[model samples]
Target chain A: MKKTLYPVLSVITILAFGFLVMYMLYGSGETPIFIIMAIFAIILGAAILALVWPRFSGTSTVTPGQSPFLVSRGVYFLMVIVLLVSFLLEGFNSSSPWSFLYPSENPFVPILSIAIIVGLYLVLYLRKSVREKYSFVELWTMKANDEREQHIIDDAARKTYGFMRMLVVIMGLGFFAFQLLGMSFPAFSVGYILFLFIFVAHAYFMFLLRKITD
Target chain B: MEKTANRLRELRKVRGQTQEEMAKDLGVTRQTVISIEKGEYIPSTTLALKIARLLKKPVEDIFWLE
Candidate 1:
């Protein structure tokens, strides 16, 4: 089941990448609206397929002492680093006046990003041991995060939420203080700070729950 | 720490059950089962009851407040 679905999903994602490249190269703002919408729809559909397909067709090869949560978290960590580094390098090098992270017209960056993502998925599917490990991980991850886990998570989340709220208040006050002092701060700095906060907070809570629970 | 000590380890060993086996029977992770045995985590009434049922012991025999 998973063996077939993975390849098909990878193909669709690559196809979406092809469409996006062609759209960027050949299509203009005056290009037909339907074409742009179709391109977007293809990309969105492929994204959803990547996440949902395995849930339906996945088979498990769970072995004792192997943890699904650990494997999946490792995968997620790798994917995030790959994605963040790729996009951040692209953004930092961009000459766009609007924002550093503004979507670059350079097709290579987007294509590279797609290639890496597809490569990861394909690599997971092609290797027998890795594939079985991933399947077991997925199975365990699903079962491990049950209602009881959610209750534990919710309690932890409430504390994290309060911390986030306090952070927002401090940032808000700082912004006002800057305004009053006639000092300037880049809007992107605030966005970056918020992004960092969210990412760190989530990772912290996940670690805490995984440690104290299973 | 206010530990809720239990004889789960002894009972499980006597029953010839590994933590992994008990975890599967109780629909939880091996780590969770380990935590319960180590007194690092206290299971809810329902889970304690389920564990008792699986072990074929009274709840009091498996767990008690310390």
Candidate 2:
């Protein structure tokens, strides 16, 4: 039952993602009805993928804490980052670089964009293969942290946190200095920069933990 | 030395056990058992004790500080 459904969902997911990307890059006027249909397709595909994906995939034979599964998961995360940045920039309408792509002012665009992302998350989070390979449940549930894993996580956290703090302080001071010099950076830019810093820090720590724990 | 040296591989071999076998008995993944054998990762106290108990060996016999 699931085998037939999985391929169809996978195809829809790919097509919907492609359509969304194109929509972001070339959409104009109102949020086109076709694009909305694409988003709905993504939602449906994602939900079905979640339900059917776990069974056919091979169970992971890799050892816990040593596999590169987390890094692989990072790929989907990268896609999410791209989609979100494009959406946020479009919504902010502050002469963002990508503003020319979809310059309209529809609020539902961002909302539907977010819905697509939620759908992606559901698919990834629900996959049996992803769950087994990444110890997905255990890590989130706080059960994967045996002593060595805990030590690795703690070390990575300390380093990444310190680095992020220092970067934020320096950037904050620099922004203040720019203000003093009559060169103003907008609060939105500052917030965006800070968010990027935190996101990068998290990715760095995840990589570090995987390396050190292994 | 405590983290680098262990008799896990040798002991398991003598017991006619595969890494997968030991991992199953110890409630861990096979890669963990391999890592322990390779001296790449040291188990927690609870896991170490479980391994020792499963293999019918003293904790000192399976793992020790150099």
Candidate 3:
């Protein structure tokens, strides 16, 4: 099966769970309707996840985030995005006021929008702006008449790993600074604090544990 | 130092295989075979067995302690 199949499956699984959840949460009085809504929601979420997940974590040889239970660094990004979006759409007017988009409120919508947009930009940069000549899996898995490219691939993977580590560190530092002085920064404090904790935790895994090294 | 794997390159050539072809067979990449050739990174046991199987040789015949 194509690698893309997994995330598609993930989205389906998520939807099925969400429907069962709505069923349990609301009781059987309107269970069927709620179940339909939940299935729709799952499909929408899955579509988004399918498009985005592969760009970030697919094409990677290493299995990230450890079984995808909860999440690992590679998968953590998707989780972060989902959480932020959920936070934003918690209670907001949709494109049409009659239509609500994801249940976000006034405050969270813009914040989450900006956050998601930034995350999008960052992913693009990693995929494009940061140019590496080789992919890591190529090093270990490719066959070569000449050995040079294999070494290059290994080196590239290592550097990419290092670069990601550096990114986590930088994000951590930025978040730490925000956490310290976020009181004056409006929601910046809370956002920064969240960012800090996540970055610190992920950085520990990325570097100290060499979690992405594989 | 003398190489440890005796006939990886020869066996591959005898099969009229390109390094890229072998890499593709492994579902990994072309550059990986080069690494194996240069002995920069040793192949995993699975990969070693695969290469041996592909070449119609036992793993023992392909690899030996130097």
Query: Which candidate achieves the best lDDT against the true structure?
Result: 2
Q: Report the C-alpha lDDT of model 1 over A1-214, residue by residue, as the tens digit.
A: 6568544644443354334333332323434543665575466445544543443235434333333333234323433453355345644554421133333456465455446655554543445533332353452253333334444444444454345445555665665576689885543344334435445544444434544334
Rank ordering of all candidates by lDDT, starting from the highest? 2, 1, 3
Interface RMSD of 2: 3.4
Error of 1 at A89 (Å): 11
The Cα error of candidate 3 at residue A81, in Å, is 3.9
After superposition on all CA atoms, how large is the RMSD of candidate 1?
13.2
lDDT of 2 by residue, A1-214 (tens): 6566545544444444444344433333344644664565466446434432442232323333442233223323444455456546563674554444332456465346446655555554445543444564443333242445545554554465446545644664565587589873442344334334444655565556454334
Per-residue lDDT of candidate 2, residues B1-66 (tens digit): 134478989888999999888887887767678778888887878888998899888999888888
Give lDDT per model, in order: 0.52, 0.54, 0.46
TM-score (all chains, Cα) for each model: 0.49, 0.49, 0.36
- At residue A18, what lDDT does model 3 achieve? 44
**B1-66 per-residue lDDT for model 3 (tens digits):** 765655677778888999989888865556567667656556767778878878889898877767
Highest DockQ: which candidate?
Answer: 1
| Cand. 3 TM to true fold | 0.36
> What docking class should model 2 receive?
incorrect
- Candidate 1 Cα misplacement greater than 4 A, ranges: A1-143, A146-148, A186-188, A209-214
**DockQ for all models:** 0.25, 0.23, 0.08
- Runs in model 2 deviating more than 4 A are A1-90, A94-132, A135-147, A186-188, A212-214, B1-4
Residue-by-residue lDDT tens digits, candidate 1, B1-66: 555889999999998999999888898767678878888778878889999999888999999877
Better of 1 and 2 by lDDT: 2
